[model samples]
Target: MSANTLRAECATPGTQHVETGHRVATRSAVLRYPSLTTTVPKEFVHRASVAEVMLTDWERREDHRFVVTAQWPRSHSFFTTANGCHDPLIAAETLRQAGSLLAHAEYGVPLGHHFLMWDLSLTVLPEHLSVGDAPAALDIDVVCSDIKTRRGSLAGFRYATVMRRAGHVVATGGASFTCVAPHVYQRLRAHRLSGAGAQLPLTAPTAPQDVGRVSPTDVVLSPIGQRDRWQLRVDTRHPVLFEHPVDHIPGMMLLEAARQATVATLGEGVTPLSVIAEFSRYAELDAPCVIEARRLPRTEHEEAVEVTGHQDGEQVVRSTVTAAASAG
Candidate 1:
């Protein structure tokens, strides 16, 4: 492959299975070619890939662990907080991009294919919920062993990632993904609806600060008659969220809506430190998806928020967002 084309896998799955984390150290026999640099072109990447967390330098020293490096740029969608800490989502995306890209390089994951986030749980240790802009020098060691194949064409796997600065723990989380190749994705459902431009019934939008978005247009859902509830605004033209059309509501849009709700309820200054979300069904664009967020008690230094979306009376999206106490 050319320099920018692809990097084929050359390493073998070594026999040495060492305990890299708190979990038992049984390595996965199914996993092959443990490490690889990401080769997915920037354009093919679903998200705006320019400032994303794609892996560069990669090396696998053990069956359960691979050491790789990724960076979040200043132009990152979620900018650094005033305290100079990177968003927890950045760390989450780091784990995601690393694994997906590695899968593409090592397992011949098709270029047009993409992995959908089914379940994700990430937590920041500190009370402030801020993982400082740990530079590119810091390498995130990922341990992956849980890989299961579906009956048809799907594959499910979970990854455990840890981020640190100067050997100090910054954040940790484990997330599960469902792989959806291009052919499989196209077969699922059709993209967009009949009236793409018709206006939907919606309450006036609250300010960007109310939803934690830097700009009002960034907010995907608008307020409803009920408090702490919103009607998902289906706009295919959204540059960042909806770069292209899709059959269902994009997972990132749900995450962003939940994040905005959590921040809106928490009010200003608080930042989303960690979030755990589960997608049960597709929030179709043809109908209205009612979003509701409930604030949990201040259990830890950081407060908690629960957001859910209902479509046709069935729960489609659910998220538990934890925000650190606002910095002064």
Candidate 2:
């Protein structure tokens, strides 16, 4: 196997400007950057997006695998809450980019198009990674063994990312995404973007602790006076969450709701070891949405929790969260 090294600089808003020479490379083509922007085609992300581009460089090893480096600015809210450890979304975003890079760099897939996310999953072991005090930066390496695509539909691939501090593996998990044409994605987001958004009917915002988060500003779903359920609060005025405007509830927020619901299911705090989430349709902001988590039968390998979100009576999101069977 052959490997290439590409380096560049990162200049995100809160990044610690290190004088140490670090080359951030995205592709075979190398160029200097006046500012840090995403190498992934803008079209790949929704017009209004929340993906924080953490990995600034790539070193491709093969079509199925690559070793990438990401430096998380200590001040980045998207990657961390009260805790310093890198958030699950960080890994999610990393896996997302790996698929994008593989499709374009390895498979010759063009950019400036769109892809649909059919499913995504990850497993976290607390002992495997340090979440109490996350490092200022990370060394992320990803590998993909199975990738599939067709001429007129979505392209899909399964990938895993390993985070290392110094030279030891701290955390690892695998996930998958399916790509679709711009038209298909637009069609899926159409109803939510129709400018018919309605103010969500819900109670006052609850504390982040109510949802397993340590920060109050991080809470988006509040209790709805229902057992084991929460009302989705689309606070467009939030800074970190609504950094900009959005048409509907971000997929990540919904997933966070699931994470919180998992906490409710277990009563005790939980570090999700495995999660499988699927989206059936756009969860509209104007409509009322409820998220529910159901306890699952215990397995020899892990304890399971299942989550679902609904708009009115229609199901929008479904997820299964599992934690390691042994105590951490």
Candidate with maximal lDDT:
1
* Candidate 2: regions farther than 4 A off: 1-51, 81-85, 104-112, 131-137, 150-154, 187-189, 197-203, 239-246, 298-302, 324-328
Candidate 1 local Cα displacement, residue 167, angstroms = 3.1
Give candidate 1's error at residue 123 in angstroms.
1.6
Candidate 2 per-residue C-alpha lDDT over 147-249 given as tens digits, one digit per residue, 9 for 90 to 100: 7768743377777788765676655766666666667767877766677656665456666665677666667677777887887766767655565576667
lDDT of 1 by residue, 1-328 (tens): 1223445545355645667677555444444564455534553345454544355555565765766665555445444443555666666666666667555544445667757777777776554334444443346777876776666433757778786656766778777776776666766643443345344443445677777666666777687667898888767666656656565677777877888788778897667778898988767766788889998978646788999999889998899998776544
Which of the numbered candidates is closest to the native, going by highest TM-score?
1
Instruction: Please identify model 1 stretches exceeding 4 Å from their true place.
Output: 1-40, 43-53, 77-80, 125-137, 150-154, 190-204, 325-328
In model 2, state the lDDT of residue 58. Answer: 62
**lDDT at 29, model 2:** 34
